[model samples]
Target: MFPFFFDPTMMLLIPALLLAMWAQMRVKSVFARYSNVGSRHGTTAASVARALLDRFGLRDVPVNRVSGNLTDHYDPRDRTLSLSDTVYGSSSIAAIGVAAHEVGHAIQDKLDYSPLRIRNAIVPVVGIGSSMAFPLFFIGILFRGQMLMDLGILLFLGVILFHVVTLPVEFDASSRALRVLADTGMLSSDEITGAGAVLRAASWTYVAATVMAFAQLIRLLFLRGMFGSRD
Candidate 1:
């Protein structure tokens, strides 16, 4: 059976969940507001990414348009920058800012950012851990097998570690994006402020995610009676 809704550890996780909800709202609000405002230079997100990559001597890194609202990302494996539908061809400030952020990841790959490198290395393991954690835990509990439960907790730790490491990677990308935008004068001061607002809001979501993962791990530990004399 699951823990009670009002259990102490469960209560502690409420704030993190609320913060995550708030972060989601903020990201959507800022993106929606700025997505309507066109940039002064009137350049599409794809064009801006290309310009930044070229400026950074990364002309070989390709920028490709992808389908989705906010599915933009940089593929380190292939060294490609993929922008979403809203960002790829749009001339809005939000689009350009998002494109720049993904390009920032590409920059990190090129410069061999240590945290990013570590994140990439563990991605496959994290993927497996995330998917198997809950199933293993539940199956172990059903069979009253301590070893299986322990193994599940161990795998779940990898998921937590991935989220923890992701915090720095995301923040660094945003910092790099803002710096590049400023140094190149690609966006006016006011425009940069707007873009910064959007990126900052987006970064909060990552923080919320990490907090949520930590809370989940702690809750699992509590359920496993890891806290002595608590059961």
Candidate 2:
């Protein structure tokens, strides 16, 4: 009996793991470096977020402070934008960049961005599938049940799809943030370059996630093939 999670297939995960770690470190390093650099106009991220939302005629979306370093997000369901401790009141370039990226999501929601809508729509199912995939796969292996194993593999595919769709959503948001930051004169031309660096660094994290998801999916398929062939 081959030990699960310790097989040769785990080697497939190595590059993905390294990339994910590098992405996290790169973003943090970039965010920290730019955090020391203040905005040219000293505009707080929260205020910038509010101004952008208002400009988009999404005046009803409220910007709220949430606790944490880089936990900022836009919750479309609640029509709320939450900025983290590192961004909410900070007038730093990185903070504003992060703030604007989140507002980009809000605007995507307002405009009904198709990818964003698809991502949001499948979220509930993805949550269920992601949670059940492994357990069911393991159970199938234990009982030598092909149907159970196939079902588990299918569930994991949903997670991979989520990661794939997420890449475009994130890229589009960063793109919007940069363009708007320039158009609104929120960040100076040189400062926009700095913000772009911060946002570009942030985007790598999503790319890393997608890479990892694909690697894991491949690992699962390899394992399933091994087990199925044995059966």
Candidate 3:
């Protein structure tokens, strides 16, 4: 059996894994802290989202409550905004922040944001790539097939590219959310600070994910000894 812990590739991945773990913890901690603090206006998350969408001339976009924690999203395909149950009705700063962030995606879609359009166009390919990457790579290794291994690496790179694209999309959404919230008077300056903290913490998770994916890709290259030769 391969001793993964002692592997140099694995050793190099440790920092990225630790950073991802820390980012996850930070998002949860910050979100939880602000989730318990009610909004100054005592407005529910759904109301805030609806109001923002309307302000942006997106009255056609409907907000719906769905079950789950932090599962809020704006589905561009259906032109619907879905908020998790906790966020939909909660009159909390965290809830409002999350809701607004999702609305930012709707705005992005409405405006045809270039990164978002590219990201959406590649979703299916990324899904297929992610599903096939592991099996193809493992089989190629077992059979010592260089072509198959190269194809597997190519597919995995698509997955990595997806993560890379996601960074800008998420960051832009958070930026739009904070700015809109402030401009619309949905949150006071101090409250916007707390919301910004939550959004920033959430953004770190995407950064960590991208870093981890890149590290994993590098580890794979190292494991295959692809860096040693000019093919």
Candidate 4:
């Protein structure tokens, strides 16, 4: 039953998984190195964020610390920038770099970035679709229900669309991070390059996830087309 599920086309999906794993591993490695290496630039996360916000004239946004490694992000909902404990207090280049990336999201939100707006608009639908799509597809197969399979396909499409839109939002955030870091002198030239490597590795994880989502959608489509009941 699962043989076709693991065919040559499925093998193609391996790279995406590897890429995602590689990205996560790279983040971990960087964190390990910087966990003890204080930022050579001598700036605290709060001060760095405050300086950047001041530059952008966004002084009202609050920056706070949240628990978790590399779990930093800027919430547009309550206008808060949440940083993980390590990133919020640590002075490593990696810490500062990640913090800036989250700040980049805040900047995008402030300017109403188009990709971010689209992503936010679809979040609810994608959330529902992702949760139910695969199970529905499998149930449709078991019962040979064409309606169920089609419904699964529609929901699966939402997940894919979210992944597609996510690519740009992520890339844009990294772009913003690099520019800000360079302009503000948060990192030395070598440090900037290292941060770039880290960001690129992180971006590939999203790429991998998108590929996996697309592959699952295609697999479902094929299964439905070939074996779906006519009734």
Candidate 5:
């Protein structure tokens, strides 16, 4: 194995990845149990969001439908809460739970949640850093330019930080989701507990993705260092 491959930095990755994958499977299964398209709760996603926002004093936020299942998100820039077509119209526990989760983000925004704020601030930086990091690192290694290699490492580190920071944001959203749902009686105790499990599992997807990204970063770093040393 390459040096970086054996590095202890990957110690937490394996479990995190496995947990994340497991969560994905669990969430999918949970959602599958209620996949009927005809189910209706008579309450629109917009209504749920409006009510929740009003309770939290965030009535200015607009709730709208967006395409794609589970693609729902709260966009802070436009102060909009976007939900999937299924989630917006469906009144199932899953739909309400998910809608509340996205709205939890809005709550986070309103409360100036630290992790969410940091994640948002780092978004553009992480994008640029991740994009240029590996390529620059490789070029640096090929050309025996330590500066380029170091810069790449630094950039890659930013991406890693962004990933690390995302964990709390996601987890906090889930926490907020459960609390809101229970507080609002959107879900019964059993449903709240069940939905919490699903959301927890869904969080693993992010964990897994972060692990995969970190793994790739490690692999690249190992290759560069080994090859560069030889050169």
Candidate 6:
């Protein structure tokens, strides 16, 4: 019998859940609004991305078109930049902001940014920890095994650390994207404002995710009797 089926500890997740919802809605609204506003310079997203990458001395990084909206990313592992369907050919402010953000990651990788390097290094271990955390915790609860629960808490700790580290990486990337856009004259002052707004709105999603991860960890700890008393 699972005692936590009706556990009150789950109440701790409500604030983060609400924040996550609001962040999703806010980003989507902002992105859609700016996506309709085309760049005055009339440059394709891929061309802009390539130009930025080359300017940053990353000529070797290939920019590729990919399907799906907002699927854009820079893969440090392969040194490739992928632009999503919504951004690959568009000349909109939203598209350019997205392209530049991914490029920011490439720049980070090129410079060997410490946080990013640490994040990339932990990816493998975090994968294992995330996959096992919940299952191990539930098994521990079912058997009243203290060590198993403690191990679960520890494994989940890696996931929490990942979320925390991601916050600064993302914020720094946005800052780089905005600054580069302004410096290269890729976007005018007003256009830069628009792109900055899009990036700023999108950042809340990561904030929400980090908050949710922390809340989950707290809930796990409470269940383990590390803090609050269990009924």
| Model 3 lDDT tens row, 13-107 | 89999999999999999999999999999999999999999999999999998999888899988999999988999999999999999999999
Q: Which residues of candidate 2, in runs, are more than 4 Å off?
A: none
List model 5 lDDT by residue over 22-115, tens digit each.
8688778876665342223456655777788889998889888999878889998888999888788876666777788888899889889998
Clashes in each model (backbone N, CA, C under 3 Å)?
A: 0, 0, 0, 1, 2, 0
* Candidate 6: segments with Cα more than 4 A from true spot: 1-4, 226-231
- Per-residue lDDT tens digits for candidate 6, residues 1-231, read 336566888999999999999999999999999999999999988999999999999999999999997889888999999999999999999999999999999999999998899888889879989999989987887778777888888999999889888988899999999999999999999999999999999999999999999999989988888322333
Model 2: how far residue 191 lies from native, Å? 0.5
Candidate achieving higher lDDT, 4 or 5: 4
Model 4, residue pairs in steric clash: 39-91
Q: Residue 4 in model 4: shift from native, Å?
A: 12
* lDDT of each residue in 126-229, candidate 1, tens digit only: 99999998688657656666667778889999989899889899999999999999898889989999999999999999999999999888877776674222
Candidate topping lDDT = 2
Better model by TM-score: candidate 1 vs candidate 4: 1
Cα error, candidate 1, residue 159 (Å):
0.8
Ranking by TM-score: 2, 6, 3, 1, 4, 5
Q: So what's the TM-score on candidate 6?
A: 0.96
* Residue pairs of candidate 5 with colliding backbone atoms: 20-204, 23-201
C-alpha lDDT of candidate 5 relative to the true structure: 0.77
lDDT of each: 0.89, 0.93, 0.90, 0.80, 0.77, 0.92
Q: Give the TM-score of each candidate.
A: 0.92, 0.98, 0.94, 0.89, 0.84, 0.96
Ten-residue segment with the worst summed lDDT in candidate 5? 33-42
In model 1, the number of clashes is 0
Clashing pairs in 2: none
Query: TM-score for model 4?
Result: 0.89
Top candidate, metric TM-score: 2
**What lDDT is reached at residue 50 by model 4?**
69
Q: After the best TM-score superposition of candidate 6, give how far the Cα of residue 165 lies from its true spot, in angstroms.
A: 0.8
Error of 3 at 206 (Å): 0.3
Ten-residue region with minimum lDDT total, candidate 2: 1-10
lDDT score, residue 211, model 2? 94
